[model samples]
Target: MSEMIDENAGGRVVVVGAGPTGLLLAGDLAEAGVPVTLVERRHAGRSNLSRALVVHATTLEAFDARGIADDLIAKGAPVQALRLFDTAVVDVSELPTPYPYLLVVPQYETEAVLQARLDRLGVVTRHETEVVGLRQDADGVALTVRDADGTREERAAYVVGTDGHDSSIRRLLGVEFPGHTVVASVMLVDAVLADPPSLRIATNTDGDKFAFVAPFKDGYHRIIAWDQSHPKAESEPVDLDEVRAVLHATLGTDFGMGEPRWSSRFHSDERQAEHYRAGRVFLAGDAAHTHSPAGGQGMNTGLLDAANLSWKLAAVLRGRAGDALLDTYESERYPVGTAVIKGSGRLLRAAQIKATPARKLRNLAMHFALQRPLVNRRIGFALSGLWVRYAAPAGAHELTGHRAGDVPLTGSPSRLFEALRGGGFVLLAPTELHEPAAEAGVRTAVPADGGPVRLIRPDGYIAWAADTPGAEEVALAIRASGA
Candidate 1:
């Protein structure tokens, strides 16, 4: 971690961590006209190990809202579907998303795109900067940071911690990371394959061991294997030979490795912060939650965290809403993060079951349950994150007080979200009735076949909607939401 910023500089919303989550939040904050300074413990624009490889549909849609997914796709691979080859080769293509297959992009490239976008939005990140601690009062939070050379103190109206699992911010806030760790430790290696296997993502089982491979750019592949029974010599560095041996033992054959790029050992831990906020400081991404990489959900959840928090932070900064809006961040996201951790952990347990008639029966039941389009849609909804619905406070109106699920809109702009690009509140009025919205100071967009009033938030969810022929009720709901 680098030194803190100078308190006398100016008012800045400090963001800790320059990873994808931080960059995305910074971009949103900048676009919302908030003065944001991102602090990273390393040099800026430095690419680290290419770890995460899958971008969920929710993340893709979130990036689409930011208009940066195309370039990311060009820089990485696109997986259109996932196939499970246990007992039967089941094609999970009919999942309930426009994006059924995951996006196979290296973590480094994803960060690059996010950083570039943040730069375009006029947000500068300070590298070699780390927050040592933070103190909060009635006004704001003061952060102590250590730079490459020295240390200093910086004061900010707000702080966001997007750091990894061992978050300094979480510690400063005294939040508990509650969860259990997996028994077996697994090693992951990224290598240039001499004969790269034609696999986008594969799970192969050999005897009691398993190897999972995911392809990446430049003929590199990330491989994972677990052989806890075979003890290794202490202090011996992991080499290509050892990696190849694990591969052969787990996958029945080794495709051969060129030069091993990166390798690390990790035991899965399913944990999430007790809370995401303390005084003027907030938490996002891994700082808020973490879990096993069962379905490649860590990065996806982190990205969604950025998306969810960014607009709300902007709302508070711009004075479009009250501090109460910020409180909803934890209420809305914490359960989702917990669900991801639990759901993925459950799947991992199911996968690790011994192959027997009983295990087969259990797997069959799971498969059958997932075979239903509605059930699969729910799973996809959970994975894609569209299913996240905030609990509206008591007495809040229905349509304008909660998020609107994506509904088919027969309109001029086509999709239901074409009218909400500026990240501002919008009031959709019936074309036949051009009455003023009830109380929300929002731009008016008439649905082509307008029959109802729809008030959408900047995050692409309908705050309050109604089938009424006018916008007055919708406006009233927006006002109820503190618009």
Candidate 2:
């Protein structure tokens, strides 16, 4: 760790990790012309561990709004729908969105896409660098960092901690990470198999164990199992032999377990930081919440956290909004993080319970509930995060609590997101008034295919939609989005 102090260093926003959350936030900040310096303890590139696999539809839309979904598709596989099974398989189609199922992409590939975007935005991540300490007064944050050779100090307008569960920033601030362990040790298996299983892989369960397998490369699979009361072996390489045994016992079939690529064991834990922001220092992703991977919410939630916070940070850094805008980072995300932790706990218990007669009866009842189209759609919405609608602040509007899906035009679909690419408020109007709307700092388009007027926010949600409304309605939406 370097120990040289340059406390007067300034202008850049110091980001404390280069994972997906940090990289995505840095990209947005950099694109907004906020000088950003991202620091990471590890060398640049994705970790070998196969952690998160499912990218929910909300995240897909977030990526698509940035024009990166095509690149993501090139890097991973796309499933049309997720198949749930208990006594039988239930297919839940007719989900409200265009993406009805989760996109199965490795976390590394997801990072790769974001990294490329970061490169395009001219943001450089300082690898092998660690944030040792930080202090904030009324003006800005003063941060101390150490690299391989020596220490250096830099001052920044704000700091964001995207570091993982044991975050140094969170520790430095003395924020209590409150929660309990899920009481299960899980083995993760990463391997390239000669042949792959045809099972639909989100999460699978049997007696006393939970199994999850996701495809990575053409022949690679990431497998994980939760063992409630298994004995630990002392071998250093994570006891690949034990991992194979657990997979074989639970799945009741051969994994085609080829030479292992990477393997590790981790205990399930559900924890969240007491506060996401303390003056100039803020937290996002796992730095704010750590939970079981039951719903594949860990990385997804973190990515969304980055998305939600970046716009606010950029707004304040650019002096367009006051620091009070940044305060909403915790107000909007803390409850969502708490809900995710609770939701994952329920799903973990539901999936891994020992099947007695009573358990079987409960499973049957759940299956019956899932059989209804409406119930299945609701479950899909929950799993995909489309059901989450943030509360609008006072005097917002009547169109406050909607997810802003696509609306079709005369011959094609008009995506509400196209208008929100630059992360600002937009007001759509009748074709006749497109020029008038442009004077209000709202980008005007004719919707070449002839659709109704719409309004989109920088976060890619529809702020307002109307049937060829006049300029007065468009002005109201602009005010609603705080333009």
Candidate 3:
């Protein structure tokens, strides 16, 4: 691993950011023997602010594919049931996966897990290195990086900007982040409440004000309160008194709130990048899109984006696939990003309803709808990301674009994700077809039911399915997957 930034390290792929998305990408690339370097502006030994707090089931399954899901689960607190609006609740204990509930852990804890995995993979992260500007060419892209010492230029075959919302690389690329700020001033703070409401989640609204309290693994709770009557700039300071007052005004009491830890103010926006790729450069995480924090979807979505792109980049660099393979990254993820932006924005709008009568009516409807077992199950599935499906090409197999969510592995105690640990597709067929390429990262498992052969992508999605598949069928699926 290259500890410090070296000049022109043989045209390695440069990942800009040390966040979870960038870490996953770099780790996956290096594990596949692709020379990659990660750059972050934060100083060494520095810790980032804890923002997002929920790691959804789909994301955990992605980590499971990479062989780090169990480690994260060991350190997180699971919430099987989530309370929303008023008396409505969503129980995800039976969400149909190895990880049935959303793991409630600070974003920093999630980052730490990725960091450790990167270290084990022998990936280096250069701190205090920021991407000032960049320009792409026919062959690759050139980045102008600034550090305390001076400025330098590094060329790479591809560059991915996984930086946060105020990404400098995204600005340099001149992509439009078109969206409006849904909330002007949102106050969020960490504190110890004498009377904690819920160990999982407590979210509700009173008139025009809303309050959400979620406990962390450290025995502290995060109080996110918003009052339309009190609009202030994000730069303004926040105080515990104000948090207490807002909680009291919105939730009828502060839950004996006191002993503030950290506080900040920020606004929520719903925006997505117009393009995920520009020449040899690509975007992921907050650089590609951003949305309101209503559903705790920000970090989870970014991690999934990294998972979707890492395999494609590794394939192209290793000469296993053609350049066109990279285009699928945008085509598949952009729609999901659009949906998250709209869905989370809609949730925020519902919570911020100004008219008291409208809010009451909406709450009544939600209460009735959530009471139905089918409706609750459906909501749980979607919110947990099990309902997310991709667009398949015309004439493709019926299950081509659907996820193979935790299928039982034949002749072992492991599941499908366990078979995908080393990275590549797993052929679940009824009989032994043929051995794939000696160098191909493919695994074969015969189902006990003697079902049709289904090609499962490294990201745990079905590429194609057929009653009988031979070497040619597997090769076609691999080519289509760019793996």
Model 3, position 326, has a per-residue lDDT of: 89
| Clashing residue pairs in candidate 3 (N, C-alpha, C atoms within 3 angstroms) | none
Higher-ranked by TM-score: 1 or 3: 3
- Where does model 3 exceed 4 Å of error? 1-11, 46-48, 437-441
Model 2, 232-259: lDDT tens digits are: 5424346666666666655555467777
Query: Which candidate number has the best lDDT?
Result: 3
The lDDT per prediction is: 0.70, 0.72, 0.81
Off by over 4 Å in 2: 1-11, 81-85, 88-93, 192-195, 231-236, 394-396, 407-414, 431-437, 446-454, 463-483
lDDT of 2: 0.72
When sorted by lDDT, best at the front, the candidate numbers are 3, 2, 1
**Per-prediction CA RMSD (Å):** 4.6, 4.7, 2.8
* Tens-digit lDDT track of model 1 for 23-100: 888887776667788998877556865657788776776666567867787877666544332432223356554556
Deviation of model 2 at 322, angstroms? 2.3
Write one digit per residue (lDDT tens) for candidate 3, span 1-483: 112222354447899999989998888777666788899999876365777888999999999988898888887778888778777787788778888888888777888899999888888799999999798887788899999889988789899999989888889999898987877678888888788876468788875678888887777888888777877788998766777777887666798887767878888778899999888899999999998888888998898888888878877776667889889899999999998888887888888777878978888898899888888888777677788788888988788889888888668635788777867667886544636522355667766555667878778888787776677777677666655
What lDDT score is found at residue 333 in candidate 3? 92
Best of the two (1, 2) by TM-score: 2
The candidates, ranked best first by TM-score, are 3, 2, 1
